[model samples]
Target chain A: MSAPSSSSLSIRDLHASIGDKPILKGLTLDIPKGEVHAIMGKNGAGKSTLAKIMAGHPDYTVTSGDVLLDGESILGIEPDVRARLGLFLAFQYPMEIPGVTIANFIRAALQARLPEGEELEATDYYAKLYSKMDALSVPRNFTSRSVNEGFSGGEKKRCEILQMAMLEPSYAVLDETDSGLDIDALKIVSAGVNALRGPNIGMLVITHYQRLLDYIVPDKVHVMSEGRIIHSGDKDLALKLEAEGYDWVEKEYSAGKSAV
Target chain B: MTTETKPDIDIDRSVGDFRYEMDYAFDAGIGLNEATIDYISDVKGDPDWVREFRKEGYRKFLEKPMPTHWATKDLENIVFENIRYYLSQGQVPKRTWDEVPDDIKKTFERLGIPEQERKFLAGVEAQFDSEAAYSNIKAAVGEQGVIFVGSTEGLKEHPEIFKKWFGKVIPSGDNKFSALNSAVFSGGSFIYVPPGVKVKHPLQAYFRINAQNFGQFERTLIIADEGAELTYMEGCTAPKFETATLHSAVVELVAMKGAKIQYITVQNWSSNVFNLVTKRGIAHEDAEVKWIDCNIGSRLTMKYPGVVMKGKGARGEVVSIALAGDGQHQDTGAKMIHAADNTTSNIISKSISLGSGRSTYRGMVHVPKHLKGCKNNTECDALLINSHSRTDTYPAISVRGQGNAVQHEASVSQISAEQIFYMQQRGLSEAAAMSLAVNGFVNDLVQQFPMEYSVELKRLIDLEMEGSVG
Candidate 1:
């Protein structure tokens, strides 16, 4: 187990399954620091599976894999350990945690990253939370509502971004964040994600459509087919896929596979 | 009050490391017999009618079979011959803490009764074993014509009011335990608020059991006159003992026209105790009665605090939370009887069963055919924390009137693995996650508690949930 050349998020030859069915077969990807990359694929292309496995979801069994965060293996660690080690996943559909307020949910996440016995400063926490909520256009009273309970799709997405901002993770994987958003919501969410792009963090934005890439433009775009990345190119590759559709990529990638 | 001191008390004879056999001025000995009833009546110096009442109650206790159908069969283990009907500190209640007996005062101190009274309560009563050792009401509240004292004093001094309401709401023959309590009922709080006089703070009573195989039967009666408002809270805890203890109490409340009464109880008995308590209230025209109860730690607890709407436009509510830990059974719920027109009642019960524990919700709501515009709602939710934990719901709701409406909802849920993993991903350990989930399951009902008590309840629940799951 050697480190990847770049000190960023990297998944090496990952093979994962849910029960007896394999989802990700030898999936390999890398996103170096200071850059955002996108994985555009059709449904069942192992897009959400990649994000869940990266976050150490309990349902999935990773038979052979090495997930490295800053050049250290995170293969056998628990989900919380991986989370505290700075891995964040913005769920395609956020969980509705009844009776847990939004403020407490985010507070617990941040509190978990703190040293044991260290109390969270209420004033500082509220201050940071209010600022982030304002940036994301979430109402102040949203703090009292149960997490995602009775929330509209847009509000739920914005809440996911609000958490990512508050946690300030080293790497984040936004899984289909644009699925349930309209044009206005998409732009607002894109802007929030764009505001979080910086030099020290790496991000992998997974989406089925290239429309999301129009706003949160990635430095590089990869086309995934059948649980593995088939081709990698610059940002224009997303536009090419969006215009020509996935049929051309599937045909061309299968041809190349057969030729090999 | 008669002041008699017994010289035969031997405080050094320890029955076991955790159990004690304190020599009582009068210990009606173990058993329910004519002699025991006569002994108790003689000790209390009851009037002729009261003595006759006790004799009748003793007969009823023998006649009324154990509610083997509704109550758990464990009731058979409560040997009537093995339980001392009454064991007191053998001292009348004093008005001040300084005047209280040292041994009893130490117990109250350990339970934080004095500090809580000094901080937030309008009055405080401490009952040790079978008698009230200390009772006091704040001067300000007393000046406003509030009455807070032990039941004995209330009956002896204010018989005009006590005689009318006592045993009226819940008759002795209503249930087996109520009859048992009626026979040996000793020390409990008796509170009265005059018309149009509202107490600013809650009146609290703390009950502690010290002797093993000793039965603590406290009879409480609370009355709120017309246009009055008051809240009463009770807390109970007993030391751990190998021998089983019996705690059967009967509490009755009466709210006059347009009055309001809120009763709260947090019972944390030792696992060796069987707590079978009967509590009910009567709400008159436009009156309101609420019961907020939390049951945590008893080997078996069967309590269903009820409310009967006896007058039109009255309202009744019961918000209860029960937690059953290892080797515990909590069969508790609420009963609402809509006997009048245009009455409303609500019941919400939340229970948690952990580590092979069992929790059952047995509720009943009834509106007769003659009543009109009566509405009742009941919701019972149970959370099972372990694979082996058990929960059951038996809700009986009947609405016979054409204009009446009744709704009952019950649900049993287990902690979700996905939710636990989600919380774990947010940095909480599995145990911490489980604790948080359990707290959330009961958070809505707990929020109905007073802020201080709710905080304390959360802490207690957290301690119970530790190591509940691996």
Candidate 2:
């Protein structure tokens, strides 16, 4: 297999696990800049595990493999350091940080990225934050609310997108960004993500259903089975998987591996 | 008394190897007696009424036994007879900073009170040992009928109002420490907001301990009149000494109808100081009272600032944060007693322990059977920074009324290395990451503090984080 050209995030032979249980076995994928990539899989198919491993989550240990951020291996870096290196993960379940406002949370993340002794300008920070919130269709007053605390499912998803848009990471993995969102909220969030698409940013959208693809319209789709990508194709693969279901792909992948 | 010029005392000898010690000129003596009390009263040129009050308080002190059972047990061992009750360099407190003696001025200057007051504080009262060496109020605030003066001066100028409520809330014999404070208390704050007036800025007082083996007992009382509001802040720092010094203080607050009073205290005594304080407040109809208390340093501290909701529809809140470092035990909490119908009270406490430090939360919320529609909520969260640290929560809530509601929640959490690693990987050093996580743990309560105080609180957390790494 040849490496995908123009890739900003490349996961090669990725193997990760929590304790003795292996979650991802030799999973490999590549996300190029200026394009949206979707990974479709069943539960426990290493979809969420891949996102967590890429974000340097402490709970999951990488047994063997490399996750490259901008062509640099980031397997040993810390989660926050991974974040500073332009890797963003929109958690499927966002942690509720009480007493920390959404605006302050995003501001702290942005501040963490700045060079030491260089203070963040309050005026410019607020101006940019307000513009991002407006683009996300979030209320201006949501800035003062606690991060994800008391928020509805759709609100949480939108908040995740808002954070992604503010951070402006080089590569973003939206883990189930469409899981809990209603139709209207899904559209707003997709629109927010679409607006942020550019030459400098690459996004990997993980979802179980192809319904979100109708709105997000990924440039490439990968079918993940048994902890690895079994098939790779264009956006039509998502629609095909949506119609045929995941069982056929899982059976065929298992048969091919066994026959080998 | 004339200013005597003595040979320059060696800085090492004068400060006695204590970080908080100051070079001040004062006639030092031990024990509390008629002579010492009379000397203190006479030095201030107190009116006959104040002298009589001091004498009466002295009698009460002699009668009240040492508190041996509640909270800090070490207080029982405090040798009252061996401790000096009062020490003042000058016979009279200067009306202006320029009039203050150079030694006393230098004492406060070393404590950084004047600079802190000038930079961000609205008003400052510096107490050296037992008397207020220098006190100043912003002219703009003074013009608004806000009184920020020492307790002794309040007795002389506003005796009618001062005496009426002086010991009414926290009586002379409320506790052993209260009795001691009443008898020997020399220099604390006296704040009164006139009816319908609001003091936008916080008035601060800095108490510096300069004398060795001396017990500094300061009495503070603040009265927010009907429809008035005020925010008062106090900080204490004592030089370290081998022989521990005793500090017992009493603060009483009264919020009248439709009034609000927020009292904040940041105590940073050295590890050799025994800080035992009793602070309480009374809220009347439609009034609100809040106590934002932080206990950072002290060998043993037994302080529980509480509130009594005495009038209908009154509200009371106590948000306390305690951080106990090495060789410290912070036994602090709050008490809320609902005496009137429809009264409400809420208490939220957060404590952090590090390096064998122990923090205990002993809180009480009482709503009698007669009170209807009373409500109470109490939550306590404790974080252990390391394995050796310990934290405990003891909440006693009793509600007898059928129409009342009460809730209590307590949690103990340890700092996870995984969380720390996650933050460190984000380019933050281990120390900086831990500080952020710790600050985030208490951010809910810290954000409730006034802006300047929150900034200072964060700085204190940073200082604690220094050298915390193994």
Best-performing candidate as measured by lDDT: 1
Provide DockQ values for all models, in the order shown: 0.50, 0.22
Residue B339 lDDT in candidate 2: 92
Relative to the true structure, candidate 1 reaches a TM of: 0.92
Q: How would you encode candidate 2's per-residue C-alpha lDDT over A73-129 as one tens digit per residue?
A: 889876777888888888788766555678876776777888889888999999999
The per-prediction tally of clashing pairs is 0, 5
Clashing pairs for predicted structure model 1, backbone only: none
TM-score of each: 0.92, 0.83
| Candidate number achieving the greatest DockQ relative to the actual structure | 1
Would you list the C-alpha lDDT of every candidate in the order shown? Answer: 0.87, 0.82
Residues B252-354, candidate 2, lDDT per residue (tens digit)? 8999999999999888887778999989999999999999999987778988889999999999999999987766788899999899999999999999887
Q: B124-163 in candidate 1: lDDT tens per residue?
A: 9999888999999999999998999998889888889998
Candidate 1 lDDT tens digits, A97-196: 7778889888877887789899899999999999999998889999998888899889989998998999998899999999889999999999999999
